[model samples]
Target: MILRQHGPQLLHHIKILKLKKNLDEHLNNLLTSPWVPENTFQFPARGKRNLRFQSQRQTLESLSDSLDIETSSKALSFLKSTLTSEFVVSLCLLANILQSTISVYKILQSPYCDLKSAVEHTEDSVDHFGNIQRTMDVKFSKIFITAKALMSQVCEEIHFPRVAPHQHYRSNYSTKDPESYLRISVAIPIQDDLINQLKCRFSDRKDLLGTLQCFIPASTTETVDAEPLK
Candidate 1:
């Protein structure tokens, strides 16, 4: 599953490509700094969302940037189109996770990253992602609270059908409110998925990496298939 950077890459789901495109276009308008200041907010060089492992690792590294004119303008326009506090918060959260994942991913890419280092990085990433429901509650704490309040209203309205939806909401609760749309209480399948992928990809490479160690040291004998000269 782990291929070289230039090897064949899969196509990304349409949703991912759209999310990245919109995110790239509006980097200037979005306030990603309070959440993640390290990101440069540059678009991935490859247009396809299903990035190669190397590409994904790189894109995660620069998922946000300080606002520039064009990016800012696009962000502003985007904000105007979808103005909602919850939506904004979710965007901030997305950037945050991406930034954290970038650190681990870079470690995995290092030429010196041996099986030991790879396992450590993968474990750290898995810990950060938090597959346990309660831990997720902590990671997405602020958003979790907001999402809960939103979900409550949604369940009451959908099942009961007697409760009237908010009439004066600036954002539409009747259709898809961010509060209801993004559920923080449940395990985040996306984060869990990435963690699983990392484990499955790297766990089997121990023997190969160990053998490479011999080749790395200059003092080590080069393979002499034939006997040495007398």
Candidate 2:
């Protein structure tokens, strides 16, 4: 004979399991539908890939709707927090940067790629990111516009965060507009960091490639000298 357990804890656990099952079913249905444009119902993939965040940003609106608010209020609230203008703008900017970075990364990862090609591609990507940093205002404005367009589709408007007066240990830049604040606080720093990281990662490789170039026939001149080789 076995003892039967009956308690409020068991009842609550059953309800929680049922809720999770329902949420899973809803997500499966959304992902399985092929009729949706761009299949926007797909959730962000889990990985060490930047594409995950890009997908998350793309499906944010649809994903938010898929959650049953009454049952998943905490999840809904957390998702909604990312829907803010600044967050969206940052997402757009990061997606833009990562798309270019991934393209270069793919080429570098190709089996056929040579040292020269790798250095060239790396430098090109660094240059591209450098340009964004140089013309940050213009580039960030475009990203901001794109963010606004995306938010508009979700019936949301761009709004700046409130600045508290005389906050403790706060480094205020005193920005009066959303664009200025976001550009300074988000876009510029991200772009700068990307550029710095790329340079740091590729600097030694570039030096090595340059030193080895003299051995390559294509890089050699008809009148190659010992000094040039050295």
Candidate 3:
């Protein structure tokens, strides 16, 4: 039912998405230009494996210094360490996804009316997010969404303040600048049920709700209060 009602609006959002993709490409091109080339290298996968194994072996050697190390025994030790490193890395990657999902769930459950309020209410969200931007060597300027014309929750702008020097990434040229970022629009088909869910979640947290509600308006039961209803 929600999709049916917002399908046309979703199509309109696609146009904005295309524009976002183009903007991202342009920014990437500029950021990766000769003068501000992103520091990246293609390490041979095999070499990476070797280094992983070596690091593990060194760790084990330090912990178990009293262990007897014979010539053939050392070769076996190296193989075991390499396999362990591969397993550890794989597990870490999986764990990262799980952790990210949990964080998303928490943000959704919070009493913020929309994503913007949620960010502000939980300043930790921004701090951790800033850390991630640096570690991931990437940044997100904004997110855009479009709903029905009658919906009054559309955002005029989303702000990301300047990242502190310690928190800023090496490749980000605007580290000292007041945080330059791209803008994104979200044009998902919206529904009353979804709006109600958001409102209910934020019912107890009025202060935070104000900010969020500004971005995602409540779904009105009657057309009289609707923004663009005709």
User: Highest lDDT: which candidate?
Assistant: 2
lDDT accuracy of residue 206 in candidate 2: 86
lDDT, residue 116, candidate 2: 76
What lDDT score goes with residue 220 in model 2? 56
Off by over 4 Å in 2: 1-77, 165-171, 210-230
Q: Tens digits of per-residue lDDT for model 3 on 34-97?
A: 2224532322343333343344444443333323356336646754543332233333333333
Residue 167 shift from truth in candidate 2, angstroms? 4.6
Task: Tell me the tens digit of each residue's lDDT in model 1 across 143-216.
Answer: 55533443333232211111246645332324243334344312255556666776677667756766777678
User: Could you give the candidate ranking by TM-score, starting with the highest?
Assistant: 2, 1, 3
Candidate 1, backbone clash total: 6
On the 0 to 100 scale, the lDDT of residue 71 in model 3 is 36
Clashing pairs in 1: 12-50, 39-64, 40-64, 40-65, 41-64, 41-65
> Higher lDDT: candidate 2 or 3?
2
Superposition TM-score, candidate 1 onto the true structure? 0.37
lDDT for each residue of candidate 2 in 1-230, tens digit (9 for 90 to 100): 12245576676677667655655554543454323485222322322223333334444434444435663455567667777766788778876766667667667778899877888898888888887788888888888887777776656778766677766653345788888888887788777888888889889998887787657787453565656555
Off by over 4 Å in 3: 1-57, 67-82, 85-89, 92-96, 99-224, 227-230
